[model samples]
Target: MKMTPPVTGTLELAHLLTRRGWLRTTEFNTPDCTVWDYAPSLPDQLAPEQKGAPTAIFLDNTGESEFYFVEPATRTTQWNPYSRNFDRLEDLIQWLPVIENWRAPRSHEHESPMGFARLRAQGLITTSEMMETLEHFPYVPVDPDAKVPSLSRTVAEIHQAHNDKLLSKNEFKLLTHNTFST
Candidate 1:
């Protein structure tokens, strides 16, 4: 679907989401985009399968944005591998309600630690930003049948790497701040 750009800036998008009864949980900025994660304030507004599912709006500098029905288990680990891209902000706003019926992609195996490293190597995201995401976002349990590593274990590994000097002081400090503040 296509629509005109009704939103001009990140702040405007945030306000629009807030007015729609979405609670902003976290905001993260990468070199290329700003991501705002949200959850419906009234759970009943979502389909039963979508209740408690998180959503995100990604605004990039190139006048394009995306809206995503975030897979709960992959929210913190992946850089939104599953999303509906929109060239206009209005298209995304118009698509939000319909998102309740949208199913998260079944392909979550791509969100491993190696996937994050690939994104960093490609300069799609910064190390500090990734660390902040890992530290701030709580782990969401996956279906018992799904085969995936424990997110808390992965986060602890990241913490240990930071302690081992694998990351710069500033990045470690950011991780520390996110960890303590939450």
Candidate 2:
């Protein structure tokens, strides 16, 4: 369950899971979001009830993501309640096995990225359902090759100094040329 710090980006998260022995089974993309389905490499790794079930990670363009367990037969989905708003990567790593074994209640039929695509293709989903689906797995317009912006080393030092109270507000403003502010 040990892992490095939690990544805020999709690609990093995917790499983390793959390194932990989860096999990427399928990847689906749309203008709004990208969904990757993963399953344990060994069947024995799954919970008895979750054997053969797949888990999904939905990554949105804004670097937000959600995890869900999908039931293969009914296509029912369950969101991992423990997976959100975590402050540490270890928290998520500890929950990975639990999430993989989690199952949605048969009585509740929640929307999943995979289920949405399938139902949408068959024309079985309504506009409202589609909207609801998107709410859970929103559009992720990520460009894999796009370079993320980073502050210059000098700027970073100034920012750090400001944070550490080594620089007064006026001093920070003067040192950064008013280009950035916390």
Best by lDDT: 1
Model 1 residue runs over 4 Å out of place are: 1-9, 25-27, 40-53, 62-81, 100-182
lDDT of 1 at 72: 32
> TM-score of model 2 relative to the true fold?
0.31
Summarize candidate 1's per-residue lDDT along 30-85 as a digit string, tens digits: 54555655543122243444423355555666335443333332323445544445
Please report, in order, the local distance difference test score of every candidate based on alpha carbons: 0.46, 0.41
Per-residue lDDT value at 166 in model 2: 46
- Which residue pairs overlap in candidate 2's backbone? 32-139, 32-140, 33-140, 60-140, 61-140
**Among all candidates shown, the one with the greatest TM-score:** 1
For model 2, state the Cα shift of residue 111 in Å.
Answer: 16
